[model samples]
Target: MRRFKLGLAAVLSLLLVLLAGCQAIGGVDVSKAVLGTLDVKSSMSKQTLSLQLVPADGKLKEEDRKAIEILNSLSVTIDQAILQDSKHMSMEGAVQFSGKKLPFHVAIDPKTMKLFVEGMTQPASVPLDMQELDMAFAGTKMTDETIMESYKDIFGFLLKHAPNPSSISVTPVTDTVNGESLSLQKLHIDIRGDELADLAKGFLTSLSKDQEGMKELIGRLYDTYYPIFAAYAGTSEDGKNALSKADKEKQINEAVKELTSMLNELLPDYDKNVKELLADSPELKDILSKNTVLSLDLMLDSKLKIRKQIMDLTVQLPATEDLPIKQVKVRSETEMWKINEPVTVHDVDSSKGVWDVTPGEGSPGAMLRHVDRQSELYRLLKDDLKITHKSFTLYSDEDPSILYDAGYEPVIVKGTLMVPVKYVADQLDADLKWDKATKQMTLTDDLTGSKIVLKMGSKEASIDGVAQTLSQPVQSFEGYAYVPMKFITKALGAEGYWDAKELVLTIERN
Candidate 1:
């Protein structure tokens, strides 16, 4: 899952750059280029990253020394990918680390997101909704899909008033990537270290002067947040208004109008403030204008799908006797293909570790509320993860109050924690069966192939049918069965730890 997260981070960044640069650089039509990246559907990609450290006048930190020795190079390859925007994406490939290739398949879909390694019991999966989990005090009108559309509008406005792209260019070119020959368009930029300060100042100056454009963006943001504030007013904490719903709506609209008028009044001074800020920050300007170089080459297929990218960043410090560093460089190369095509991610044949709990009707808890008690997700959530809530709490005591049904919980007996059946099931793969009439319990350990049988109110149990005396009888409480922790650990070849203060027992499988 961590690997999938890293891959997803890289994908989001790459796509953001693609979208932002659509109308940014020269030699491209604004209308066509702005939508260039949106046509992408699926692809295959591989990337290599290299970082080099240069020590300087002073001795480096121990961690820095270790990094130079152990963390200099890494490579990731996505053999198959589906990029239907950022959230609906998937990839399958291997990561090169420590001279070994670790294969992985990671996917984020509208219904599910999953990560699968080569030797895992099953693919790690979760029910995913490609929408924001609005857990706000008073929920906003903004949602995942809406925010994406808003970002597109915002980026378009930004590019409209941006500095002309004399520094960036696009040219027709032919290139072979990953042994595939193709005709491509290369959008390239090479920026010197000293040019960054001027670029920043120029961009800010341009933005400050664009009153109409800035007003449009500000108005859009107001629309986004207006409903949120109004909704918050209906909640307990923020509710001060006694107005009816219709009256509240009118009042919020009036407030927005007044606030917007005040904000527009300040736009006139924005240009002045930008100038003063740049003038006041000489040290910041010096740092940006020195010791750094950034260059990028992005390739697009005939369909405007971003196909390959190469980026290099180099920084060199002007080291004195007291300086700690001299020069550092980082570079990455990525290539992609199979655009707008069907893509398949990793799947598991066995449902051992994989769980899909996206069912039921309402909120996230609806799944838990309606889950079949016999299902794997139910067992995992109720036993292993120990999640007992149907909804998230906004606020809670430092030590949360635990609620147990039928007064069912673990208790200590003879200085040993006699845990309930649900707690014993936390081994994850432990198979449990009960005979209601006889109150006989059977447990099977998958890892060790060991079996145990215990009868209620009996101190004698059997390990593989061999009778043995337990630490104590399988104590019964409030119609809930309990077994001694010491006997369970030894019988199953597991280790146990009892936290007396917490009155809980932890079992470790061998």
Candidate 2:
């Protein structure tokens, strides 16, 4: 009986394991659950100029026939050409481009063998024969259909093969220039974001309950849906210029206002929960206040400026310790310009390594034992000369011979020398040591008792027994110390080698 019970238990355990595996592998279909509305609209327009040609005798001649054939060939070529607009909207992804339907337009006059072709902004005309005219028109129609089908295919892919029948309307209009009326065509498409969102929600709700999977689905849908919606809502290139900064700001403000109003309307019931969450997360208060930006700037200047400012900001959330609330805070100001500039010197002692400076607009002289004009430390002092604007001082407290480390090398920035710590230590023959207990790293000279200790997140340094200051604090990566490589090798009498082509650095002791 005991053996039978044990066997039955084992069988049950195996079934349980199988069931758990199934649950994990076949969790909710995230694409269906979290994806909310996707709306897209596309407009394309083309204008073409045509020149008519006819036989002087008003009848078809052999030469006329050949001219017609040439025109026909040109027409087919033009008809097959596809032109896409610069503007694009991508959401969970109904991708749409600016302008009206039929990316390219072809016009043909069979009797005259005249051909006209139009793309996004340019128009071309040629004379063609009846056969060429027919072929061109057919090719144009097929091309338009293919483009539309491609759009649909992309949208279908984003919607996870779920079909949402779209409503399309095409109208032909005429415009008169000089004495002749030209054909103008417009294609309009309307997509509903709410419908897409509803579809996504319904799909997700029907799937097995998997909160994590559902959340992931929601994120994916968000990424897919926005670009499509934005493209559809914006004006086509032919119709309007790109949105200006003021216009973008206005739109963002309006969106925020609308969101706030909605939240206000719903907050009455959820206030208690929200208040509790906020109370439990004091750090989020700062983030909620200062983290608002209308758009992410893609320009080089804007990107660099924003990145430099935000790089030092860190948020730490309380985890594994307390309340189920979100906490965010800017934990470091090390990168702040004000904080990083001109480290204060406590003593004005006229020492070889000591330096003084006025606040701005003066040259600063840095004193060192052995100056390698090619080294990073030399360049740093040179660059600082412009920033300080006033004559500053530098004291080399240690033997200058230590600068001859085999692991020291120059860092290039914009083809100029800069210093990075990781590059220096690996170049020198000495081992770089990181002490997590003290959040410090030590570069020790294997031949001498001399060592330089760098504290993470501070510009302060301790070389041998003397405390010194640095222009910049040491940076850390993955809890490891990263120092200015030049400083490490120079302090250790090591040599540094930087292979620019391969972007590798080696450090070895002399």
Candidate 3:
């Protein structure tokens, strides 16, 4: 039974992943506009959940007494009682006795159509009618399928009672109740309003027509809810307790005060990081604007998948002097995952792609492959693979002398190449400095103060300890310094390999 409950929990968690961002139950919208203010006020009433038992002997067993005690203790801890505008709601009631006898407490809310069980574990099934549960469980052995079907029934019951029942699922649990098997089940319910549905449909429809408007709408929606969701999820227990009562007005005020103080203290540094990210990714501004709904969908997907790749991004507008903007504030809050891989540069014709560079280990290096030049590949080689910046270079074995020594033969037909200077410096923990006045490039190792200088249009180079002669002169073009791609890279302890298709330069250290 315990294993079955655990399996059920795992299945529910997996379902949440698959169902995220899906418009389940068709066109339902549960946005803030539809739900009004989600300022739910919850209160509890004192009630002892009792259970009646009938034994095989037609008489009460002594073990039933111990079972009741266990049930009472469990009920006190797990039972959830809430008062929403005088509509009372409670969850989970159970009683247990000694000598391995146990009885479960059952309560029903006719208004909400929610069933509360004490001692049996799991929430009252949703959307499922009583008849459905009886039919599903009848003649079935205790198995994960039985528990899952039962929970689905309960979820259906809850959906029927919800104001806006759009998307719903159950959370995972494991049963560990003493003397009886029980599992705690959480029902995740999403309610949508008519307005929200219209907004979603409008947004999706606009994607094919008015892309700019879609972008703006998505940005606005993101700004509107990001902070609200962040606060709700991040709020401390004390903060929640303070907001639970109207009488604790002062407490609520204090909590808000403390929260603002914390934000003020933290926002300056946070804003700087956001600024840096935005500088590199300007499109994020539109994605995080106030009118956007796609942002919410992205966030919900991230949370369900447990990925942290995009979460560090925060968008802000440029500050002005007269306004004296000390810090950029994030008014709305939503979570995103962080992505660590190098950013890809597309559209070589665009201004951002003019450099023909790709991000390397430490800085950007020149891109060696042209992804869209189809004629060049067909004229040179017969392969049909599409090219990207990372595409491997190809070479013919007939021209082995150009890349490798005459004694060595090439076996692989494909290879890759990189800029030699950046590759070398990155591995050695060194920095590259350029002097425009003399067209001289310097490589400096900060740890050892060792330097190498190469002057443009000159075949002579100077290492820190000795002068060396280069087979090819250093070259400079368009504010970038270029050296003999093969010789300089080889001198820096990097390796160069050429295959039938391409040449590759790789850093050997760090």
Best by lDDT: 1
User: Which lDDT tens digits does candidate 3 get at residues 1-510?
Assistant: 333234323422332222233233222322311121122233332233232221222333455544434333332222323333322334333332322223223223322233322221222323324455444433334333444444444333222222222444434444322223333332344322222322323222322343333334333333343334444566433454334435444444454455345434433344354455446655544433442221112112211321111111122233332322212212122211122222221111122222222223222111112222233322122221211112222233444334342212222212222233543464454577878798777887533456778887787888785888876565433333445545554454344544324433323421
lDDT per residue, candidate 1, 282-344, as tens digits? 433333344666677878776667778898887766555554456677888888766666655
Model 3 regions lying over 4 Å from their true place = 1-430, 445-450, 476-481, 498-510
Model 1 sits at a Cα RMSD from the real structure of 11.7
Summarize candidate 2's per-residue lDDT along 1-510 as a digit string, tens digits. 333234323422332211111111122322222121111123121122222222222345565556544432221111121112112211110111111122223322332211111111122223335465345344122333444444443333334423222332334445332234544332222322223222332222322233333334443443344333444556332235545556655555555455345434433433354345346656434333323111111101111211111112222233332222223222111011111122221111123331222234121222222234554434433442222122111122233222223223233323332344554444333456877799777876544557788887887898896887765466544433445545555677655565555544555542
For every model shown, the clashing-pair count is 0, 62, 72
Give the distance in Å from residue 422's predicted Cα in candidate 2 to where it truly belongs: 7.6
lDDT: worst 10-residue window of model 3 = 305-314
TM-score on alpha carbons, each prediction: 0.52, 0.18, 0.24
Cα displacement (angstroms), candidate 1, residue 149, comes to 2.9
Tell me, by TM-score, which candidate is best.
1
